[model samples]
Structures are given as C-alpha cells and as structure tokens.
Target: MEHPSDRPAGSHEARDLTRTLMRTEFRERRSVTTELAATTVRRPPRSTREIENSLRRRLGLGRLGERLDPTPWLWGWLGPLVVTALAAVMRLVDLNHPTRLIFDETYYVKQAFSLLTLGYEGDWPAEDDDENDAINSRFADGDYSDLVSEADYVVHPQVGKWMIAVGLRLFGADNGAGWRFSAAIVGALSVLLLARTARRLFGSAALGTVAGLLLAIDGVHLTESRTSLLDVFLMFWVLVGFWCVLRDRDASRARLAHRTAPIRAAEESRAFHAAADAAARPAEPDRPAEPDRPAEPERRGRGVGVRWWLVGAGVALGLACGVKWSGIYAVAVFGVLAFAWDLSARRAIGERRWFTTSVVRGGIPAFVALVPTAALTYVASWASWFAHPGAYRRQWAADLRAAGEPVPRPWLPDWLNSWWDYHLAMWDFHNGLRSEHSYEAHPITWILQLRPTSFYWPENEPPPEACGAARCAEAITNLGNPVIWWLAVPALGVLLHTAIKGRDWRAWAILAGYAAMYLPWFAYAHRTVFSFYSVAFVPYVVLCLTFVVGWATGLLRPPPHTDGWLAAGPAASSRRGGWRTDEPTRLARFLTDDGSVRPTPTAWAILLAVVALAVVAAAFWWPLWSAQPVSYDFWRAHMWLPSWI
Candidate 1:
C-alpha cells in the first residue's frame, strides 16, 4: 500500500547509493530483455491496475481495438442472434414432413391433444393387436373419436405436455407441424440461451456464437428439436436457472463492492500512513512510544444486497422440475452454488466473518428464494390435475377410506392425499422400470455417443422405400456430433483440473450441469434408459469444448479476474458499456497476449480442425438426422459403429 519515496537529491544516501541502484536496475532490465528473447516472459509484480494497462498498451492491444469495432456492444448481441436464427431455420423447416409420430411423440403429443380436449390426458383405444400404425395415421388426420375420456396413467408431469398443447392450439392438431412447433421453438431458444450464457461466462461474442453453432449442429439436439419430446424443455429451463444464478453472482458482487468501498479505502490509507510513520521513526525499541496506530475499518456487511436473480432461478428450476423429476438435481446444485458465490464475494471484499455472515444473511435468503419457490412452482404445475377429479388417482384417499383400507396422510385433505398417492405411483413406475430396449446406453457411453436411439427407422418396414438401390434407410437417430461430444471428453477432464488447480468459477458452473444431468443417470443404469436422455446436458458438453477453444483463441490467456478478460466480461451482462470510463479493454489481448501470456497457435489449429470435422460430420449425417430417404448402403456407412445400428 505504501512505496518508499525517492530520497532527497542532496542526501548522503541518495548520493552514495544512486550509482549502485542504477547498476542494479540496469542488470534487472537486461535480464528481462534476455528473458523476452525466449518463449515466456515473467511479469514483475506491481501494486496497481496501471501495470496491466501499461503492459497491454506496450503490446499494441489498446489502440488496435479502437481502430476495429470501436464499440463491440452491438456485435456481441448481433452475433448470437445470427446463430440463433440459423438454429431456428434448421428446427422449424420441414417439421411436418413425417406426418406421423416418431418414437415417444406417439405418447406425448397425443397426450397434449388429450389435455386440450379433456381436462386431463385421455387414452386412445387399443382394440386390435396390430392397430398402432393405423391409429397413428388416423390420429395424424385429426380423427380422435377413438380417444377415450378416461385418465391415462402417465409418469411425467403435465408441464411439457402443456407446452405442446400451446402449439396444437395455435396451429390446430390436424396439422402435423403443430405437434412439434413448441419443441422447435424451445429448441432454438435453448441455443440462444446457451450462446448468451456462454458469452456471460467467457465474455466474448465469438465464443458465444461458437457455442451456439455447436449446439445447433449437434445431431441429438437437432432431432429432438424437431420432435415433440420433453428433454429439450427440461434443458431449456435448467439453462434458464443457470443463467439466473450467474446474474445473481454479478449483482451480489457489485453491490458488495459498492458497500465495502469506504472500508477498503480506509484500510489502504491506514496502511500507507502507518508504513510512512514507521519509516520515519528512529531505529530504537520503545522510541517515544508512538501513538497507537488505528485499526482498519470493519469490512463485513449486514448482508449482500437483494438478489432477485435467486427468485428468477427458483421459478426457472421449478419449471424445469415441472418437465422432469431429474431437474431436481439442478435445484440442489444451484442452491449451494449460489450460497457459495455469496460467501466468496464476501471474502473477496475482505469480510473476516464471511461464513457465518453468509449463512445467517445470504444463505437463508437464497434458500427461501430458490428452494421453496421451486417446490411451489412444481406443485402448481399439477393444478389442472387437481382441478380435474377424473384424473388418475385423483380420489385415492376417499376411495381408501370407503374401502376400509390404509388411509395414507390422513391429516391432509382427501384430494391432496390422492395427489401424493399418484406421485408415489409415478415414482414407483420410474424407479422400477427395467424393460430391455434396443438403444439403451449407460451413462459412461453417453459422452462417447456409442449407442444412439433410433426414433424413426423405416428401412425394415413391411415394404421399405426404394432408393437408387433395392432398399433405403430413412431414420431419425438421436446422436450428437462425434467431434464435439467426443472432444468434450478431454475438455471435461481439463476443466476438472482447472477447477482444482486454478479455482476457476466457470469450470464449476459447467461441471454443476454435468453433475446434475449426467451423473444422476448412473443411479438408474439398471433401468431402461435411452442415450437420448443425454440431450438434457448437451449444452454443458458444448461449453466444455468451448473452454478449450477459449484457451486457443487467447480469450482466457490472462486470469479472468484481471483486466484482460473482465474488461469485456462484465460488459456481456452490462447493458451498454458498463466499464468505468477509465477501464481499459483490448481485442488484441484475444489475438495476442502480454509478455507473460501468448496466443497458443497449436491449440487454435486444433480448434479449427475440430470445427471442420463437425461440419463434415453434419453434412454426412444430415439426411439420416432429418429422416431423408438415403440409400441403405449410405445409411449403413454413416453408422460408424455397429452398436449405433
């Protein structure tokens, strides 16, 4: 905090030691020059922000940015929007081509229509052994006369079905595209959300657009987008929660800094004056018993300011759980993550009692904001089920009392007791399911993409469509891009290392998604699980790959806490330029780096190669992913692994 001032020019030491100091300084500068001749240059430690600015200015980054994109605010948003439009076009085009349900669309989309017609899901009649295809064809034509009014015993909640019902209402269930319009819209929005979230995490528009591109081309995402499935909505809401938590972190930190500024200034001034007074004292013990130095002001706050983002996260996560029970994992991880962030912010601002303070002030409020809100939101998702008494198990408690059976939760009202019983039944169905499936994959192989589910495969039908050859394969397979998914394997490992070694927040943020979406599936390995479930966490896989790409592009060459990254990092969330007027930003820092850091050319080449491979893979597999009729031989060739078949 204090620096030794230059001695008076006429002082004895100034005259005697000046030559020696000059010689030492010359030797240090020469040694620094010699080090610069080699690959790495160690930066001399300095006590102010100006050191970094001076370094960037010397490296030609400060002025170059002024010349190109004098203000990058517009481009940051424009870039992700452009990529999101690409995703929208891909998802929305030809959404009605097949005209029939693919895989679980038979169950979900029909249930959505049933919800629209009746107050709850109604079952379709199964009068004949071989009537499924005939029924699907009839149903696609809007002849739901066979749809029964009885409540169907569905496992998942009603939120996803309600989403599909929106599209069906708008476009009419008779039109085929209406079945999937909701999915297509949510899917495209997921890409935009992922791009925007990545931009917030990494602070670069180019990186955000790259994340969007990867997700857009990813096979499972594209297929799921065009199909009326539940996982994409689950993914979207979880991402919403994740983004909200990030916003909460920034908001809380900014407020903490604002509150503690005076305290920090007092500490710095006290430190500087103390050092000067000590230097001026005579070199003797108990010299005049100098006035007792003042202690630094208390930096601890009553609490971090209002974190409305926690409320947003609560609602988003609740909606996610409304889609699938698996979303509960995010609810857990994000709650602790947000509390930890508050604690970290307090400590960063020099709070000596951060842990206790966070628990009393920050943690309790965050829990109220996130957990209870999500629970209530999830409970509210079943409102329609409660309102419709004919819904499955809606009168379980009343029946049990009439039949003289065990009355579970007797203290609750009969309807709530029935709802609990219904949820228990759903849980039992999910927990005990072990039916064998052709495309089931363990969690280990999800990242590897070894077994992809075939949602539609008409090649082995009674009379397969002919291609240029005797047979053809038109299929919709839920697979990810081989390059990005496979590439994330190593990137995930590196993120683990970085989180441990560098204590980076970005890695922890991403790993939390993997922990929720991917790891919990291992608990259900014995159940009939499809590889398609990996779609819930696919955004994080793209983010993992992008982390390495960030390194390659030199966006992360300097510690993100420094001006190198934060200069533009805050601006990602900041409305216009949130940078303090004197704050410096440099684009060349992303192209090249200061002495201690340099652009990794080899890593950049590898990233470019990865992008090319993904492009090629997308081209080769587009027909199959889109269910276009391709020659049987071509489809077989696209199946790189026999297990994929």
Candidate 2:
C-alpha cells in the first residue's frame, strides 16, 4: 500500500518520470575519441547541466507520477468479493427471524407497501379499527385492506421506499424476508464497494479487505441490513459517490502528468543546448542565431476535458439526497474537496497560473459537472410523484392556482412548484421534530456507544417455545461492536493528527466523510435522533481504524523492488514539497536494502489480538444483532454498559 505521493521520493517512480524523459543526457554523456589525427573530444560542461536538473527538481517534477494505485486488479477485486460474500451470508441467514416490524421498519416497510398499492404513500389502517390491536397487526398478517385512500403526508423522499418496494415486488409482501431483502442486498454490496474504494485510496488490497471485514461484523450495520430502513440505502449511495471522487482525482492527475511531459522534455532540451552554446560561444564567433523559443501549446488556455467521473459522483450523491436530506452535507463538502484536489494537482505540475488555471481548468468544470448533475438527478428521483398527482403535496400548485392564489416560483411548471412546496414542508417537519423518545441520543456520546437504540424486543409477549428457557430475551439492538467502536475513538485522534501535522490527504478524506455523516446531527441535538443513525458513517470509522492500524503495523508500506537509492519511498521531493504521506515522503526510513517497513513481531501480535477480539465481540453480539432468542442471563451478560440495555 504505497503512499508515495507520486511526488518523486528520490525513488524509481521519480527517476522514471523525470530522468528517463530528460536527465539521461545530463548524467550519462560520453566523449568518443578517434585516433586517426590525435583528435580530442569532450562532453558538455557540468555547471549548465546541474542547473537544469536543479530547476527540474525545484519544479516538483519528481514528486508527481502518472500511475496512482499499484495494486494488482485481481487481488483488489477478489478480496472485496470474498468479504462481500461473507456479509451477504450474515445479512441473509435467518433474516426473517424477528418476523415483525422493528423500530423505523414499522414506518418504512409499511410505507413501501403503500407505495406499491397506491403509487404514493397512503395512510395505514385507522386507529379505531377493531383489528388494529397493535398499529400494524393486520398489516403484519398481509391484510393491507384498510389502507386510507388519501395520501399520508410522508416526511422522507420516495427513493428509499421505492427500494423497499423492489423487495416487496420480488418476494411478495407477506413476510419479513420480503420487507428486508433489498436492504440486506444493498448493505452487503456496500461492503464490497468500501473494500474496492479502500484499495484505491490506500493502494493496498489487504488494507481494503480489513476495512470490509470490520464493517461486515459491525452490530449496527448487521442489524440495519436485516431490517428495512432508509439510512442503509443512504449510506450506500454516499459511499458510491466517495469512491467516484477518488477515481476522478486519479484520472485528472494522470492527465496532468501526461500533458506536462512534453513541456518538461522541451525545457530540458533547451537548457542543455543553451549551456553548450555558452561554452562554445567564446571559441567561435560564427554561430547561427539561437532559434526562437518554442511556444507552449498546452499551457495556453489549458482545457480540462470532460470529467465523467465527477458527473458520476454527482449522480450518485443525488441519489443519496433522494434518500435523505442529510446527504446534502456530503455534496457540499465533496464539491470543495474536488476543487482543492485540482488546485493541488495543477500546482504539482508546475503551472505558473496554478490558482487561476485551477479555476478555469478544474474548478469551473467541477462545479458544472457536480452541481447541475446532482440537482437534475435529485429532481429526477421524483419521477413517480410527478406521474401520480395524488402523492403527498403533488398537487399544491394546482390547488393554489384553482383557488385564485399566486403560486410561489410560478415561472416553473406546476409539478416542480409542488415539489418545492413539499420540500419546504419536509424542511419544516425536520426542523421541529423535537418529540422525545427513549432511544434519543446525543452526537457526543455516539463515539463511545454511550446509548444504543433498541429496534426490537418482545416487551409484552411470552417467551416462545423455541427460546428453550423460562426467561428468554429475544432482541434486535442497534448497537456497535464494543471492541471496534471504542478503538475507533482513538483511531480518530490518530487520523486528526496525521491530517493536520503530516498533511495526509487520505486521512483528511476519511475525516471529511466521518464528519459529513456524524457531525451534522449535533445541530439538531434537541430533536429526536438515535444511535442507529451512526450506521451512515460506519464505513468511515472502519477505514480510520484500518488506516492507523495498517500504518502502525507497517502493513501500509510497500516492499522495496529496486536498488537502495530509489528503493526507499516516493521521490525525496515530496518531503521538502507540500504533499504525500509522512514517512514515505522521507524515503522509507529504517529500510532494509531489499525490503522496507516490515511489521515488527510486537506490532504483528497487537494486530492479531485486535482482530481476534473483534471477532469474539461479533459472536457475543450476534444474538442482539440478529434478534436470536437467548436466555435472559445470556442477554444480560453481553451488556457491558448500562446504556446498552
């Protein structure tokens, strides 16, 4: 997992990027001698050649590389596949065990069936119905007969419910498996996506696999997968957008390196000739005029070609916003991050107009690709609501116009105006949603697992015969794996240190995602929120811990494959320059000639112990995650903290 900023580390990649293209003549010239007339031949003077090399180094050519990730594609994909398969099994096995609507599933799953039946969210059976002993008792038995004809004033967007509707359509809505199939499928796929993304970000398949493994075993992720809810879908799309952004960075940088290659070669050629001419000018008065300086074609109005990856990211994040409004935070943060990445890339390539060029070449294209694409896709997600005017708030514009009232944003069509109205209403509902609940938790305590939301427990029902104990507890709790979650708190500290002190972009990227998912809730701390919402950032937490663990264990560094001088790390340039990972930029410190950064025995032991403990924690918490029936004493034993109960 090489962190070589591709900013040459006085390493092989640097030598190949610069020296192979232009430095060979400066360092490897030979003077050929002929004995025919006692003639003497000499090479160009040293001072001029040395100056050119100095300029090239100062230009930061050695630090940038064309290739980004060096991992073999096979391992990159295979590891994620294996981890995804494991996650699928865990999510799918006995998924219907609880066989009841739990937590928010009671709202979303039934809403999904409502979408299927009415082409819009419809009200459930009335409160006074004789059969409505519990809210969904009849609906649980597939008796969806009492659905009200009116649209229910649904708070969230339709995209997530549409996803649940896919499952209900496929497996029939009569059972738990049907309600949850899409969530389980999407959740497992998120594991696959995270692993592949980690491989690209860290340049190591092993580290990526470790990230996937942690997410697969997380109690919150596992429980959410086995239930139908919106957040899991929201998490999946945000991850998809994050992965796309990483690809866009690589693609743009690779292009920058290519466009600048010819410029570097031209400059080096000019420098070599000018030096030779100075040495010869004193000896011969007759010399042809120095040719006019060649024009730099690429530098003038440098065009940033179509950024398809940025467009893809916008679309993916738009889908996320379609699931939940909280997704807007990622859209905003990522837009700025993309611009910053472009600014850094241009500066790395020695553009004199780095700032202005970034605006014209990178920033403008980025905004165009991301903003409009995201906005259009977000609006497109409402296609169904547009088709069915009976949907909640779908006819507000029409109703207002018919009553002789002026519509807000009347320039837009009626459907769009109505969508705007619906959004306003949703915003109002979210702002004032302060109704208290037992499961509400503060964002500050989320890192410590200080409070966990209970999704399911047979509060008033008798112990089923299958429990095999007089006092058994069956539950589905949205808690975290204690070993992993607690350790991640310290891991976050490590990430913050690396991001601020070492300027590791990967660390900053992870922190950005973590902040996007977890921090915004603090603004609404007075409102009803649950620990389960933390599932949205579980992937980032896993990456943070995996990144720190891999670094400390030396698993993040790639082994040496070249001679000692260039074998250390990325070009020595990255250390003096502004970017790249901390130790790799300093030339693989403490490196063996043949290999570097091998994990010490003690480091290996600690890593092994951590993995083993996490596995044990997963096993101990599986009953709660999966809603398996356990003896009351067994359930009590797993609650290490009072807040868990």
Candidate 3:
C-alpha cells in the first residue's frame, strides 16, 4: 500500500499508467486534472494494498469494515474441479439415455438434419404423426427431397443449429451422442471459462476454480450441460465474451501505460534540456555557457497496428451474438464500457478535449473494430448454410425472384440478399412468438429461479428403476441450488445499492454484466421464455455476490481515514476501522484495554454461525438440485419457502 512517491520514477510505471488511464475516466476526470500534480504525484508505486485502500475510501467501505478477499485455496480450485468433474462424469455416463430425442430436440435435431441434407431447414411431411414411421419413410430411405417448398418458422438463431449440425455431421443424425455432443462440449467449456474468469476477477486461481465448481454442481447448469439445448451454447459464448472483455480492459490499460510513459518522460527531459540550453546561452555573451541538460528518455508505441483488444472484444461479442440473438445485449453494454475506457485514456493525459478525443480516436476506432468484426463474424457463422444450397431459408431470395417480384435490392449479391431476407424472417418469428408452453417462466422469476424448467421426465422410471436401487433412487432435475439462488436476492440488492452509490467500479461493472443478459428478457417475458435463460449471466451474478460478501467480511481495506475527530474521541478506536460512531461499537471500544478494541470471541462465533447456516442450507437443497430421488414427503419438507415450491 506504499504510495507511488516512495518508489523511484523509473519503476512507477504501473501506478502512473493506471493514473493516466483513470484520468480519462469520467469519474476520475476531475481528480486527474485537479488532485494529482507536482511533488505529490511522485510516490512509491501502489500495490494491491494501495489499490484496495483507494477503492475502499472512495466507496466508503472503510466505514463498514475491513474488506476481505474471498480467494480460497482448496475451495477455489480443488472443490470446483471436483464438482465440475463430477458433472462431466454424470453427463457422459447416461449420455445416450432414452436413446431418443427429447422435448424440443425433435424440432432442432430434425432441422439440423434437414440443414445437413438440403443446406437449410425444410418443411416436414404434414402428416408424419408417427416419428418412427416418418423416419423410416423419409430419412432411412434418404428421401430428404420430400421436404416441402415453404420455409419453417424458427424462433431461435441458426448458430445453435449450426452447432447441432456439427455433431450430426460428425456422428450422423441417428446416434444419441450426435445431437448431444455440442451441448456437452460447450457445457464443459463454460465450466473452464467460468473458472478462468473468476480467477482473473478475484486474482485467485482458487476462487476461479470455486466459481466453476459451483456452476458445475448446480442442477440447472448440469442438466443444460448434458442436454442439446441452444441455451447452453448461448451461455458458453456469452461467458467467453465476458472473459474477453475483462482481458480487453486489462490489455487496453497496459497499452496506454506503455505508450504514455516514455512520451511523458522524454517530454520532461527535452523541456529540461531546452531550458538548460537557453539559460546557458549566456546573457549578452558575458557569462560562461552552462552545459546543456541531458537528453530525455524516448517513448515508444506499445506495439501497434491497431489495438488488438478492441478487435478481440468485437470478435467475442460477435461470436456471442452468433450463438443467440440475446447476445446483442452484451455487445451494447460492453461497447459502452469500452468507450468509457477511452474517456479514461483522454483524461489521463490531461487532454482538455478528452471526450472529443475519445469520440474521434477511441470511440470511432472502437466502433470500426467492434461493429465490422462482429458483423463479419456473425455472417461467417452461416458458412455451413452458405455452402449447402438446400439449407432452410437459404434460397429465400431465389424464391422471391421466381415469384416475379423484382429483387428488392439490386446492389447486393443474390445470396447476400437472400441472407438479409432470412434474417428479417427470423427476426419476425422471434418477436412474434407467443406460443404457450407448459414450462414457460416469467422474466422476473429468473433471478430467483422460481419455477425452473424440467428438461427430462421419464414415465415409470423412478430413481430405483434407473439406478437399480431397491427403492426409488437417482434422478437429475434442472433446478438451481436453493441456497445460492436465495442468497442471490440480497446479494443483488447489495450490488444495486453499491452501484447507485458509486462505491466501487467493480460492483458497477458486475452489475452491468448482469443487465446485459437479464434486463433484455423483461421485454420479451410475454413470449415462451424460461428461467434457464438466466444462466447466460449467472457467473457474473455469482462474482458480484462474492465481491459483496468479501467486502462485508473486510477482505479489502478502505483508504486510511485522516479524520482528526476519531483520534480525538474519548473511546479508543479499534486498530482496524471496524467500529464506527454507532452505539454497539462505541460500547465495545469502551471495554478495551491499551486503547485497542477487539470483538469478543462470542461475536466471532456468531459470524461463523451465519456462514455455517448458509452451508447447511446448501446441503439441505443439494438433493433437489442434483435430481436425486427422494420420497414425495421428503421433498415437501425441504420446501421452506412457499415461493420456491
């Protein structure tokens, strides 16, 4: 926590860079130009301690308690790895179960098959009531040409279908593993991605691992990971996009630092040398000429073509959108964040026109990097469809021209026109969908996971029958662990309040991540959406909640309070600023010896009790979450919350 002024100027690069970047941040703009200047600017480089101290002071976390970092060693990685491995094993074990298509897989799988044969989803026989009979006549005979002329209305995007088609192509459409392969892979990858993201955010590999483990063990995520549903793929890409954004943030700042430092030093040195030369020039040639000041350091570009990070951010966002249309939310939110980084950059350099520079240099280039890259990647996702002529919706443009209406746009190629038309149709279908579904979930309940969707149900298949138990045995339910979901409620409240208070940028950043994926759903809740859709942003929610818990536990320290009154108070304050002007703290301090206050062991025990309660709650709901078979009576006993039931 030593100040940068304590360090030599040569080694103060990191803090200087951060300061430079923060200078452009609108929140820090005034401070950039005002608070920091002259001798005070030279300090020993700030470390992890200094960073937290500044944040704690800014966010008023000092008034609450010493902040804590929740990066657990064993719990972080080992626990999460064990949980995730268990999930992976479970998914791979009964992977071929039922040996048949389940739920909406029929439509998606069939469409995928059609895409494989005809390069587009085709119309199915109007009266193929019996699936076996229809497959025998159509697919078995390889008569895919039986598809009708009309395009089928599909609600979701093609990226997911393209994923499905990959497995189908590799394993053939007839096998169980063929349809489920992509889901399993994406699910596992998400676990890995979550772990990495958590590691980065917490600066703890263990915390990252724990986050992944929690996600892996969670019933809903496990089930989706096992299933061939589009939502799982959507979650994977969205998480990947988020991780990339985080990387981009760190990288951009590093680049700004590298580029700005030498330039500043060199400028200072040159100014020194020039002034020395001018002063030494001898007034009226009477005095001996003083030696010129030494040459200044030269600054170098951090290495460039363009900022690769902006490009990376764009590509990640584009890939997210490619998976699900809802990924558009991430693109918009992150785009704003990236621009905010620009503002930080401009203000860091003391540029009066920081906003304008951000708009012209940072903002404009960012759009160029993000927009075109995303658009191209999104379009490229359709390569399979483009390669195959018979894919569903592939020939829409040809169909239009054949109907004798002039092709609407003469400036584009036929395929591009056809693709544009297909997008319009897809958009219409998604927006207009109002189909009633038995498991449709409301958007509001998504946060709490009320009424989780059941992905698999077996008739006459008790856990005993499936697992060979003497009694009802094992099952898999796609419900969240209740303790986690329940705690998230208060966690979310803490996040919202912190964001509004502008206490910590991390809190605000995490909140932005949630809003990107979740807020957009409120508008479409009337459609047949499900609570499972919230999985896309669940990792961020977990991170935000963890951050709050850490802050509450005093993992991160606030800025040192220079308030004179505290030292002047009659009651000695605690070594750490855990006690405030409150009655309880004051009383506790009054009982202290050596002017040092310490909470009793009993108080510490109470805190431990709260943690113990949360763990117990988690264990109680583990069965329901894991889909293990329990008697109906036992299941009812766990339903402490009526809303949960």
lDDT scores in order: 0.76, 0.76, 0.61
- Model 3, C-alpha of 501: deviation from truth (Å): 3.0
lDDT for model 1 = 0.76
Candidate 1's error at 202, in angstroms? 1.1
What CA root-mean-square deviation does each model show from the true structure? Answer: 10.7, 12.7, 14.5
Model 3 TM-score is 0.71
Q: What residue pairs are clashing in model 1?
A: none
**lDDT by residue for model 1 over 275-393, one digit each (tens)?**
55544444332223344366756656556556789889999999999999999999999998888777765655446787888898889988988899999999999999999888888
Per-residue lDDT of 1-645 in model 2, one digit per residue for the tens? 544445657677865656444544432222111121122113432443343343334322233432332234556777789989999999999877677677778789888898888888888755663444465766668878768768888889889999999999998887888999999999999999998888766666667777898899999899889889999999999999999888887676555655556565666566556544444442222323343354453443255588889999999999999999888898888888888877766665556787898998889999999988988899898888888878888889999999999888989888888988888999999999988888888999998888998888876644657577778888888899998999999989987877665566777789889878889999999888888899899999999988777766665543222221111232221121122333341122211111234445766676678778988999989988987878888899988888888
lDDT agreement of model 3 with the native:
0.61
> Each candidate's TM vs. the true structure?
0.81, 0.81, 0.71
- Misplaced by over 4 Å in model 2 are 1-72, 128-135, 270-301, 461-465, 558-597
TM-score of 1: 0.81
